[model samples]
Target: MRARKTTMLALTAGALTAGLAAGVAAPATATTSVLVKPGKARPGQNVTLQVPECETDGFATSDAFAGSAALDGAEEVEGRAGLATIGAHTPPGTYQILAHCGDVNAVGQIVVLPGTAPSPRPTPHGAADAGFGGGAGGVNVVLLGAGGVLLAGAAVARSRRRDDVTA
Candidate 1:
């Protein structure tokens, strides 16, 4: 009986530790290079260039660009992003996109698919207007903690009940 209780306590501690560790969120790593959304795009389609490592306003150059797209507004590193329109006349091929920050340079590419016609550019809107983050990528720490506590409590209660019956 003594050995059984000891084993149960050890198992409970292990379970609780594992649960807490799982609940703890990992730190986000900053991007050190440019990232292009929609790696494959049709001509005249707008592609977003993300330069999370950039500190100042910059621009992106590409043969596919209507012209060089300006990366401006919000000097914060994470906020460094811009829109580059794929030229209607850009040939169907993979084009290298080079983004230039203050002193940082990052490269990415966009592939223009063949045969898509250019459409009118839609009005740009704020991210909030997109209504994103609908409770996505969230960890329910409070619920997890509560569940762990309840599990530990139940284990202790069952062990005590066994003791009471034996006594």
Candidate 2:
């Protein structure tokens, strides 16, 4: 039993030493690289961006709408991973992706075509001038009030009999 134990210990040590000597050991520093998957997509389509996991690592996007590259927003990196999703909104052309790891950075590309136009806009209705919340209340209320006042004045005049006036 003692010899078996010694042999197992010796084998474990030998394996670890061999790994270190062959430079197959784990790296002390991580590889700094950024990659985009399924990077190409049509307009109004979405693509995934992979970023290095960092506390402040996030993503940005650009569009032809601005005639320049633009960034959408940044998201929190979770558990050694950072990612972003971008939609193809720029005019049909090649697009660039910029991946960031805190201060570190990477870039990716995609082709966006005028694959489809936006859905049609709904038709607009003419202004309603005969309803509430319109200027209708102002005109209607003032007219009704004036008519009532005039009616009351006529009724009072008829009710009263003026005494005969001497000229």
Candidate 3:
């Protein structure tokens, strides 16, 4: 009985050690470089990007766009690849697509066709008529009031707790 118990404990310890070592020895898998297909595209077109070490939650960007380019399938292909849509408003130029997976970054370039048409601009409206002036001001006032109340409540609770401890 004693020998059997000892053997079981040893096996458990060995298994646990192996598990811990595996957890520590493994490195984070992240994309080292981005590979874009065709290397050139017109506006409002889709491009496939491959990130060999990326996870499903990666992002892609372009300098030509105002912000991050629209990305699809970031969580697909076991996290190694995704599809990026070229913005229609992106002007004709040579731009780099920046891909980010965790702490790793990859970059690829694409040339935009000059003949592609630009996106249309939206019509402007007055501040009040556009639901920006009065409505936004009221929301700000309500948020400020709620924040003040929370701060005041926290101060009161802290003071009461301090007084109780002193007593």
Candidate 4:
């Protein structure tokens, strides 16, 4: 009985080693993450850029994201890849970023038009009322219109004369 017990213990140990040799252990899974640099943000505004982790679709966050440094509460892309970034209200112009993995590029654009200036009320014949210049353009326009009308009338008279001759 003692020999049988020892043999059982050795068999158990050999079986465990053989199981490991046969690759029954879990495979090594590596997690790869890319570092995303936040793009240009407004002075008083906030921003966030998602940092993508390793995924089957190449490299990038599952969903586009953005945030300030230390992306704890910011948007995160996990278990995904080949996605764009997310951001809003960032400065007033084009913004660009170099993606770490060169898989997806991040970019942004903002146009900050200057605030409207209080326009002065226009007065007819006054300095502020001089729309796109002075009376020069107005006279030119009137002369052109008169010339066109005269030309059209002359054309109609000539057509009538031709008709009369034909008749």
The residue pairs that clash in candidate 1, if any, are: none
| Local distance difference test scores for all models | 0.81, 0.53, 0.70, 0.44
Q: What shift in Å separates residue 58 of candidate 4 from its native position after superposition?
A: 2.0
Off by over 4 Å in 1: 1-32, 75-79, 117-167
- Please estimate how well model 2 matches the true structure, expressed as its whole-model Cα lDDT: 0.53
TM-score of each: 0.49, 0.34, 0.42, 0.22
- Each candidate: RMSD to true structure? 33.6, 11.2, 22.8, 13.8
Using lDDT, rank the candidates from best to worst. 1, 3, 2, 4
Each candidate structure's count of clashing pairs: 0, 4, 0, 6
How well does candidate 2 match the true structure in TM-score terms?
0.34
- Pairs clashing within candidate 2: 61-70, 61-71, 61-72, 62-70
Q: What order do you get sorting by TM-score, best first?
A: 1, 3, 2, 4
- lDDT of each residue in 21-136, candidate 1, tens digit only: 87675433333566888888888788988887777888999999999988876654374789998898888999988888776777888999987756667986644433345444
Better of 2 and 3 by lDDT: 3
TM-score between candidate 1 and the true structure: 0.49
Model 1 accuracy (lDDT, Cα): 0.81
lDDT of 2 by residue, 115-139 (tens): 7535557887766566766554345
Best by lDDT: 1
Worst 10 residues of 2 by lDDT: 64-73
Off by over 4 Å in 3: 1-31, 65-79, 117-167
